[model samples]
Target chain A: MQIYLPIAEMAIPAESIFFVSLFVGCLSGLFGIGGGFLTTPFMIFMGVPPAVAVGTQPCQIAANGLSGMLAHLRKGHVDVKMGAVMLLGSSVGTVIGVFVFKLLKYLGQIDFAISMLYTILLSSIGLLMLYESVSKLLRKKQSVKLEFNQFKVNDFVATLPFKMRFPKSKLYISALLPIGVGFMSGILASILGIGGGFMIVPAMIYIIGMPGIVVAGTSLFQIVFTTSFATLMHAVTNNTVDILLAVILICGGVVGAQIGAVLSRRIKTTHARVLLAVLILSVAVRLSMQVFMMPDELFSTVVR
Target chain B: MRIFLVVLMVLLSAPVMAQSAVTVDLAQESIDITTGFNGADLKLFGVRDAPGRIAVVITGPQREMVVRRKQRIFGVWANLSGIKFDNVPVYYDFALEQVDGDEESEDVEARAALNIVLAQSGIGLEALHFETEENVGPDDLKVFQGALIRNKQAEGRFPEAAADITFMSDTFFKTSFYIPADVPTGEYQIKTYLIGKTSVKDVSTTNVRVGQVGFSAEIYGFAKENGLWYGLVCVMFAIFMGWLSDFIRRRL
Candidate 1:
């Protein structure tokens, strides 16, 4: 059935909207990510309009992040101090990003900019993940217990001033590092209309040298706040947030996520990563094609 | 003495014009758009003393629209140029009906039958163009305007073919058209034009209000005004929904 979206000012099939979110939510459940990168593009392709898709996606991400954070909180996997530090930087980034989004939208270049960003971001991440997972899978089975320096503040990192100790992470590093990482991810999240889960997960794991056990939880913790901030900013400034669309998506999303979580246990880690990589690459390719291909109708009309 | 002359001039012109007296009415004057609104169909009923041709045009409220034409730049399709048109109808639908099954000979008869005044009139969509104001590049405004109408027409917002007006009796005629659900909510004017031989004999316009009425209107209003609070509510609602779904999942 079709339903009218007030903010988007269009009628869309509710089932297609629900099923798209469901698919993305399933991916999120399987990959331990917010699935914004997938959902935003898919919504645009489904003719939700680029601005509405970008503005409303953060609501979905925030909900997914909060749910994930709660689950992690139960397991005590979140590094509250680290998450808080990153949250500070990310919040500022989100404000700047939303402003940029507004500027691009005013200039009528938002759709082009979004497609370009997706192509670049998805391609890099998909290739890197695919390479890493493939190499790991081919390395055979060795539980090589290497000496862990995940929490160790290296001499160079420790001397950078403003050293803060994260008791949960068990590290003393320059506060600027996590803040900077958070800020980058925040900008990315707002501009790209994503949860920044994929970027944040790797950043926390590799850059901050946080333990893998807490990476998902801490990343989700920061994501919840950053996405929430982005959502509000888009709403107040652009008025693109469609509450009905978000509700329908979230309803399908949460259920799909649960199903995906159950299904993930049956798949191997490398296989799942490979599948995600292929999915990401395919979407990236499709988006790039849209930019390069000649459109049937060269003109786009919008009523003011 | 001036009034007597004016009345005498009107009486003298009445027989010379020989125009038809027409009256038009819509089934519903107001359309209520609630959450249950999908689309609606309106029956346009009318009475005419003279029988020749009946044409109905329903046009929605006018608004400014920007039409952007993309160009291949730097190996990518980008919106490099655009033009803005003011006072363009957001929705336009028209129906034309010919009576008496005189389709082939009406053109010949229309030319040879009566003393029809040569007025500036015809069923041409191009004539719908109003004053244009440029907002962007030095491109032809007509091109963009035509593109706008073409695009809207393709989307079913612009009527492709006019419905046939069927006469129920010698004096009564009616026609109907389906309004798509995506039609923008606003005031619409249903114009009924009575045509004779070569010129428009008489024209009547009726107003129809199409506005969001209940829950949808309230939400739309809230979002438009209290955007920040609406955003907050949306986020909170999403969170609540997520939690509820998780709760249900656990139980299942």
Candidate 2:
């Protein structure tokens, strides 16, 4: 049941890889987020080299985004103009991010940096989502009505000079806001080896005032391009991508996403949000524990 | 002239006959690593003309490795410093057998005697040499080398203790060594020494060729040689699997 991974130069159990991808894929489908935040750390914990785990993830993420984007596209939920503008900014952000990643790698601090970044990102995002959901739940119990407001451009976002109209989302906002948001998400996606869906979806909702209907599809559209480009860049520059690992993950992930999408219909959105927040918080806590706790073997040897 | 030559040859052969003579051969000379290869057992048998003690040692190919020690920088553990060890054996195993002795006495004598032979012939794992990079101090070198050995032993790549060599008969003796699946494939040497009271009387050596075979080998080679192409292929494979899975899901 073990297969030899040529690039990583190690043998790992086939089923373990499949199951991890399946679980993450299910979460991605249910939450409408890329599971790279979970997959990268899990692979490292399972003994894949940190570089290979990071390098190989973009390929899997790109595939997942493509499949998910296609589903959303059929429902007329994507704004191609907005996605293109964001993608342009993402490309610039990804280049800068990859450079920083290489610098950290050369300093032998990549692992430490990655863990530190994840701890901060996941916990903050998870806590914020948890707070919002809990307050909404309380308001419902008190008979306070929740309003789905009509899309309105924020005063700060509307004032910028370069105006763009996205007909699909029925929004007229300065293009700079979306570009800035895309740039940040792109940098995060490359650095963390994630699709950055968690950050981008919320940004699209609050900052650009994009309707909820188009957010998921629009975000996924940018993710597919950014991640695919990142994968090729890492492969050519770092030579760290393990193709075998990507294939195994994609096999399970595609199927798991379908199952998750089907299951999402049965659950309430409030409950799903709470569960997702808990999962993210737990991963952050686990990562923090690893950093704070003493390791059993203080010395590690690497073959040159 | 023919009679005089025959007499000279007999005089030279007389000394070899009087003392012990040793000859050794492995059960197999080459090992093929297929996809199903987990590990393999090697059978080495040898004979001696006179009764003495025997020691067997196996050393795999040597390569450079880095040993890093994690330091508590602020609150988190990180790899602060490391030393590169040059010419370290990737795998090592040793076995010893005493012709005549009890357990307690043999343990003490065998160790004392084996050290002497190993030092002289430079044949066993203990005989291996290590050198450090320019920046590493002498004391630091010792710490790194010790850590290297300790980690390798924990990983089961190096033997913690030598196995006992069994003798099937008075003249014929044999020992078995296990090569784990994780053993790096390369040229290896199996050396058998006939140990005397003072020094090594005779030595025999055999070679083993360990390399990957079949489909796995082809893939491994491709990845190592054509890394960029390999990466491209892997990406394509991922896309294909993703597409296949999505298609299957829709049908179901």
Candidate 3:
């Protein structure tokens, strides 16, 4: 039996929708995952129009991001300079992302392309995180301390003219790195309707070799502007930002993030990644089912 | 002299009857019509004073009407009762035409007839009208109207006071009432009216109070206005948690 929701004209209950948001919020705060990866697809499954789901997911992200950023800031883990630089780059990249989005939307191939990319990117990232976490757990008995090193390579990325110093991060790297990272983050943020903090955090930690402690805070700082710009742009152009729905999700998400952040400290580092992997895999499976399984009704005519 | 006096008294008594017997009752004087974001309802009432004729002249902020449907052979294959508004303060003007029938006849016909009153205010507006029945086919009738009072000049008056209220769907609507950063805090009335053939019915009114701005306005004002502050506050909370975790780890 199919039901219709008066709010979104989609078939979903208020309780289930609340729970999905809550769960996504918890995971985001606890594991540094962008809940958009989960919430967007979940909304689609519930029959919300894609544009609305994409537009509203950022509000939820904003809630989660704010909570995480604050928590990290208080921990003395935020590198303000690095974050600012990255935000500057990401903001510029966001404009490009919007243009790219318009082009793709005009081409009418955005949905298929986004879906395919999401499936591939999420699964690969999920598997990699899962493998790393599991391996770390298995080797937990060994007290291994990896040395942090700053190495310069002979590539264009390494030799970029603008070399900047991050005193707090204790690194002097080309400004190009932060800009490149921001550009990538912006593209992903716009395309995925996420803050792109998940990718940004990992990139800062591994690629830039920033301390793990600073990763969440730095990424969140950048996310704030990226998502805010995206929200504003979507509101002005598509007028799809529903403040009512956003408020409800934010209410639940803010509470959930606080609890999740407290819980994050109790869990092992590897365990957080494992949980994130599980979430990604589940979302992927659900999305794949929609693609493979026969839909109850096929839209023969185009809506737009 | 006695017959003249008797005739004068009867004439005075008859004139008194004609003056006092007629009464006008506006029973549905004040009614409130509350609608969700996208849905619309008709605010209607009867005018008893006007015995033979009635006029409804609705005037307010200007509005527009756009209809989306499929035209079928039988007519339009859709329900045409509940009109949708993309924006708020929807205004209209309606009038009633008297036929050679009794009050009962007029009542039955009034159900099907409606006058489309356009917005008089030169504000950009849009509207969609439909019949108020379920499973019934479309009415096949279209009403195009604008505001009754339009500002002749191309310029807008009270630029700061003007606000845009847009309906997102059935339950959610957004109004960007620009309280200029410099505007003084006070109580303002937001009024909307429903105009019928001969009467003016105020449908809805809301009072908005703006308070003194302070620190909350600086950090949270922007957030409160644009709804970004909630997220910013959440981030602050997460950082606090992160700190608490680190503090605990250090002690352990």
Candidate 4:
């Protein structure tokens, strides 16, 4: 059935919103990732304005992150100190991001900016996942062992000022490192409307030298805060958040995540990664076609 | 009862008959956009005492609008440049009264004559005007203006082809116009033109009020007026939903 969204000022099929969130939520639960990379673009394709889609996403992501954070917290894997420091950086980053977003909206380039950013981000991330999963599959067939030794704390990251100790991760790192990393993801989260856990989790383990066990928990911990803060900022500054849209998406997403979390136990991780890679890549390709292909109507009009 | 009501309306406004040859009234004077309002079809029936032909035009709620052209920038189509126009109607629709002709009209010449009359009286699309201080050349303005009309037509805000103002009887002519759900809420004019051979003989304008009410209005009003509280409530709602879902999952 069609439902009118007040702030977006449009009527769309309620099931379409629910199903998109459900699919993305399932993927996020199956893989330990925030699927905003998929959800935001899907909404845009479904005729939600880029600003509304981006603005409304944070609350849904915040809610999804909370569930995951709770699970991780129970396992005692969250390094709250590290997550807090990163959140500090992200808060500043989100402010800058929202400013840029508003500027782009005024210039009427928000659509292009969102589309372009998604194309670049989704493609690289999808390709990386595809490559890693394929090689791992091939290696298993040949029984070749993969090495676990990853990043060394480079002298530059080690020597930066304001070193802080995170007892949970058992690491001493420069406070600036997590802050800078958090800041980058925060900008991305605000602009792209993704929880940014996929990006932030990797950065936590590789860049900040956090323990792998704590990385997911810490990333989820910070995502809840950053997304909540970003939602507030966009709602206040841009007035773009569609609360009704968020409600439908969150309702579908949370349930889907629960089901996905249950199904993840039975499914092989490698195959699922490959499937997800394909999905992400397909979205990127479609976005590229939308941008590069000649439109049937070359002129678009916007009401001011 | 409906026809009787239509006649009664004409008789009530008969006192102004000497001042103008035409008088028009809508089925509804005001429309409330309650929750789930899609769009509204307005029944406007009129009387034109001295008319070679009759036409109805509806316009309202002027707004600033921009028509942007797409250009390939870095191999991607982006909205590059735009012509901003002032005083553009957010809603525009018009229809001509079909001359006494065959009901199933294969009468091309008769329709052509009607078009000629509409064009001459400036009662149709080509006569619509918009102003801009953007220092644009006439050709660029024409292109953007045509684009604007085309877009609006596609959106059903403007009639692509003239719909007929059908006559119910010798004295009463009625036509239906749709006000789209997305039409900006404001004052609108429902004008019935008494088209003479080459000019408008008499014009009668009626007022229409479209306003948003109910849940949709409440939500939008709250969001715009109290952004901070709305945002906080949205966050809280989402968090609670998340927590509830997780709680349900564990119990299951």
Candidate 5:
């Protein structure tokens, strides 16, 4: 039996898709996630073709990110300088990543590579984050002091010749770090067809030692361009972008972002980090299972 | 005097009646067509609307073609739906023999059959079977058939009192038609038609042609084949690496 999805196709009934987007958007804003992790999988589950699913997720990211960024901007959480530098690097990296992506497709190993990589990455991140959060809680119960010792200056980053002062982050780091981060994020965005906000936010916070507020803001800033380029490139070349699906996801994500921003104000930083850690670990576990466990149906084809 | 005046008026009106016949001129005879990596733009000329049907015939290279319906509402243009056709190479002699000896009386019938066959061969109709249409509002339109598209409009309606039609499918297949890089090009004709209740209402045609070679085609072509998995894998890897670096940094 064929079922009609009126919300995605019909303008009048699009609110259904919008509501779903809103929910995802809120989570993206609250957790400082790109929501691509959730949205793309959800789209696939909804019977959308893989190509369309990947292509449309970015438009949703752009919309949700815009709203989330606006809220962060008002809170003075954005580091414009850091974001600008990162944007430059990401732009260059994304273009190169696109080329590499094409090569992989021509080779026909893209699906296996993507699945293997995602499984490994998500599971590892999830496990580590979960371990850290649990440990932190246990230590807090035992009356251990949580000092800011992680803020110590690194010689590798600090010794780089071109040092630039980040007034907002209150750090003096080499331009190389941001550029490197941008390059990595850009390649990821291009290859995975995602906004890369999930990776960028964590990098900013843990590696660059930017405050959580700035990390989230900067990540969103970079995501806008990264995903925009991906969207345009996909539309012109792959013709995979389903504008109908995009509209549905974006409407939902935007509303969700607004609610998420409001809820974020109430959550403590430590708790937020812990939640993020747990989320990452859970995704990681799921990915690892796919790699290690043989399927009941051995002949089952993996959806691209 | 009245009788003489009536006679004079009759003689003068006979010449005006002779000049009332309509004449149509198709500006360009043939066209070279090309398709984008994801989509293609098509145009044909010398279209005429009769009582119950609209017809377009072109004599050119063996190629594929898609016929679309377009509508204009509130000064905006939009595609309504489209049909695809395939053209097979045929000599004039073969075509004439296929029509049989009653050439004059069966001209219209023969033309219709040729058009249908060309359309069926060139443009695959698989996508058309699953097409869907949704009216969002004043300016939004969406059309889809599983993995194919008939037409889509976002901000405005079609400019004519007609529906804009577009044809595209998800299947990745190669075609025989190729636009040469160094061919001398001139204006070509694009034929469009409108189907109305009980009859074909209006027929229109436009001129379009390929010009100098540009980078868009190359860029678009490369992207179509590789963009999907590349974007997906790279982003996932970045997330993994970022977290790994963080974990290592903390451990040290």
Candidate 6:
């Protein structure tokens, strides 16, 4: 059936979008990623206005994040203090990202800039995760339990001023480290219309040196806020957020997220990381193709 | 059958468009754009005593439109120069009278005559023009205009060709306008043109309002005026929906 989206001023087939949103939501819940990296392109491909697609992504991401976060919190996986610190930094980053977005829009190059940045960000992060996860998967299983401080980056982060304890994550790192991480992710999230979970998950494991099990839940916790902030920015400034579209997305997303949360509990950490790495890499590759490929239609018309 | 009967009643109530024998009545007073609105197919049936062709034109509200052409810039397909056009009607649907069977003897000649007349009168899609204050060359403007029309046609805003205006008989004719879901809501003018073998004999017009209705309409309107509060509501509503879904899932 078709549903008319008010802000987008378009009618879309509800069933197809529901299934796609469900699939993306499952991946989000499974990996604790916001899933915006998938749905935004899907909507745009389906002929929904790009602005509306980018604007509506955050609302559904928040819903999916909340559903997944609740599951992880129940199992004591969330590091509330760490998530809060990162949230503070991301909030500032989001504001900056919005300003940068406006500047790009004024240059009449925002569309190209977004596509280029989106491809670059996704591919780099995907490669980083793929490398780390593939190395861990190939190693002897016992080394998976190696001490967290083995990475020199952790040593540098540990030596920074204003150390804060994250009891849930079992780490004592400088607050500045996570805040800086959150700040960068925040800026990227606002600019690229992603929740920054795919980036943050790797950062938590390598930079903050958090354990695997804790990374998903904490990243989701921060995601719930950053995406929510981005959502607000889209609604307030662009007025492109379609509530009906968001509702439909959430309807499918929550179910998938719940199923994913259940599956995550059964899978081994290394396998899950590898699966996530594969998923992220595939999307990145597809998006890069979009940036480089010649479009079938070379002309477009819009009314401001 | 019920929808047709309802259409009949609405048409009967519509005010007579011309003092002459020619009568044009729209099926509905206004097109209601509710949440479930996919698109609207409005019926336009009319009677013309004059011996001529029947054509109906529905023009929607005008707005400033930007037509962008893409080019390979530094090996990347990007939108390059754009031509800004003002007072461009967002919606323009035209339908010409369809000749029935056994009319092929002069169908080609009749169509050619109609095309020449329409071109001279500045009617139909081919003659579409918008006065622009941009510094673009005339050649560039023509290219951009073609692109704009092509894009709009692809979006179902403009039909690829004039819709069929079927003649119920020699005196009565009927046509319909398929207003797309993405059509901007505002006052629309529905014009019925009576054309002789070589010229327009008469024209009649009726105004119809197309505005958003129902629950979703309220949200669209609210978002336009109170962006901050609307964003807050959207965020909170999404969070509540998340919690509600989780609650339901646990029970299942």
TM-score of each: 0.87, 0.83, 0.53, 0.92, 0.49, 0.86
Task: TM-score chain B for all models.
Answer: 0.78, 0.83, 0.24, 0.85, 0.20, 0.84
Q: For residues B139-174, could you state the per-residue lDDT of candidate 6 as single tens digits? A: 888888888998988988888887988776667677
Model 1: per-residue Cα lDDT over A1-304, one tens digit each: 8788877777788999899999888887887767888889899888888999988888888888788788788899999889899988998999999899988887778888999899998999889878877877898544322333443455676678798988898787889989998998789878888887777776676667887889888888888888888888889988888888988888878888888888888876667888889999999999998789998888877776
Model 4: per-residue Cα lDDT at residue B75: 78
Model 2 / residue A56 / CA error / Å: 2.2
lDDT of 1 by residue, B165-237 (tens): 8877766677776777777888998888877776787888889998877778888999999998998899788
> What is the C-alpha interface RMSD of model 4?
1.4
Tell me chain A's TM-score in each of the predictions. 0.92, 0.89, 0.84, 0.95, 0.76, 0.82
- DockQ values, each candidate: 0.47, 0.37, 0.02, 0.65, 0.02, 0.57
User: Interface RMSDs of all predictions?
Assistant: 1.8, 2.4, 13.5, 1.4, 19.1, 1.9
Of the two candidates 3 and 6, the one with more favorable TM-score, higher being better, is 6
For this target, which candidate reaches the highest TM-score against the unseen true structure?
A: 4
* Candidate 4: tens digits of C-alpha lDDT, residues A1-304: 7777888876777799999999889888889788888999999998888899999999899999888888888889898999889989999999999999999888878888888888999999989888878887777453222132243487777779998888888888889999998898789878989987767766776678777788888888889899999999999999999998998999889978987888898989887788889989999999888788988888977776
lDDT of 2 by residue, A1-304 (tens): 8776656656778799999999999888787778999898889888787888888898899889888877778788898899999988898898888888888777667877888888888899889878877877777453221132443454665678888888988888788978988898778877888988878987888778888889999998888888877776777667777777888888778878988888888877787788889988998998887677787887767666
Pairs of residues clashing in candidate 2? none
lDDT of every predicted structure (CA atoms): 0.79, 0.78, 0.51, 0.84, 0.49, 0.79
Worst 10 residues of 5 chain A by lDDT: A1-10
Q: Write one digit per residue (lDDT tens) for candidate 3, span A168-208.
A: 88878888788889888777766667777667866786567
- The DockQ-derived docking category for candidate 5 is incorrect
Q: lDDT tens string, model 4, B17-87?
A: 76778887777778667557777888887776765678888887889988889998877899999988897
Error of 4 at A217 (Å): 1.3
- Which segments of model 6 are wrong by more than 4 Å? A71-79, A102-111, A125-176, A208-215, A265-282, B1-18, B98-117, B244-252
Per-residue lDDT tens digits for candidate 3, residues B1-252, read 533443344335534544332111111222221112121222222212212222222222423323222222232122122222232222322322333453465565453332223233221232222222223334332221121112111112123122333333321222332222222223443433333533343233344443333432342234435444444443344344434534443444
TM-score, ranked from best to worst: 4, 1, 6, 2, 3, 5
Of the two candidates 1 and 4, the one with more favorable DockQ, higher being better, is 4
List the candidate 4 regions with Cα displacement exceeding 4 Å: A140-150, B1-20, B100-122
Model 5, residue A102: distance off in Å is 2.2
Which model, 2 or 6, shows the larger lDDT?
6
